[model samples]
Target: MNIAIGCDDAAVELKNTLAKHLESLGYEYTDYSQPAEDESNLYADVAARVAYSVAEHKHERGIIICGTGIGVSIMANKVPGIRAALCHDVFSAIRARKSNGAQIITMGARVIGSELAKTILENWLQADQIDPSSLPKVQRINEIEDSILSKSE
Candidate 1:
C-alpha cells in the first residue's frame, strides 16, 4: 500500500525511523515531513497535507506525528472526509483502522519510544478495515461528518 507520512520538528527523528521501517517492509510511502531545522514546517501544516492526500485518495493511508500528537490529530480531522485517530498503543492502532476505518494515524514522539512506535505502526498497517461488527458504526461516523459539513457549507 502507498502510505504518506509527516511530522513536526519534534517528531522528525521518529518519522525517519518509521520511514526506514516502511522501506524494510517493502511498502511505498511519501514523506511529507520537513527537516528539523526548517522553521516553516509546522505540525498543523504537515498534518493537513498528509491528511488531505489520504482524504483525496492520492495515498492509501497516512501517519502524522508531533510532540503530543493531539494537535496534529485535531487539525487533520478538520478535513471533511479525513478520519485521523491519535493512537499510541498496538490495540488502539488496530482499532483505529478496524473499527473506525481511519485513514490516518497520529502519534506522539515525546510520548512513545521508537520501538513502540514501530510496533504500533505495523499493527495499524496490518489491521483490516471496518470489521463486520463495526461497519454500521463506521458508516454512521461518515453520516455524522456529512451532516456537520453540510451545515457549515
Candidate 2:
C-alpha cells in the first residue's frame, strides 16, 4: 500500500520508527514534512498537507504525528472527507479504520512507545469494517457524528 507520513520535530524519531515498521510490513510511504533537524514545526501545516495528500490519493492511508497527537488530529479532521483519528492503542486504531472509515491515523510521540505504535499501525492497516460485526461499530460512530453536527447547528 502507498502511504503518507508526516510529523513535527517532536515526532520525527517516532515517525522514523513507523517508517521502518511500514517497510517491514511491505508498504511504501512518502514523507511530507519535518526536517531531520529540530525546527519550529507546525502541526497545522503538516496536518493540512497530509490531509490534502490523502484526499488526492483516494485509496492511500496517512499517518500523522505530533507531540500530543490531538492538535494534528483535530486539524486533519477539519478537512471534508477526512476522518483523522488520534489513536493511542490497538483497539482505537482498529476502530478508527473499521468503524469510522478513517483514512488517517494520528499518534503522540510522548504517549506511545515505538513497539506498541507499530502494533497499532499493523492492526490499522489490516483492519476491515465490512464484516457484519462492524455494523454496530459504524452505527455508534455515526451516532457520534450526528451529535457533533447537531451541536454545531
* Most TM-score-accurate candidate: 1
Query: Residue 130 error for model 1, in Å?
Result: 1.2
Q: lDDT tens digits, residues 1-153, model 1?
A: 999999999998999999999999999999988644554688988998899889889999999999999999999999989999999999999999999999999999999999999999999999966899999998999999899989989
Clashing pairs in 1: none
Q: How high is each candidate's TM-score?
A: 0.94, 0.81
| Top-lDDT structure, candidate number | 1
lDDT of 2 at 151: 92
Candidate 2, overall lDDT? Answer: 0.86
Candidate 1 residue runs with Cα over 4 Å from true position: 35-39
Position 112, candidate 2: lDDT: 92
lDDT against the true structure, each candidate: 0.93, 0.86
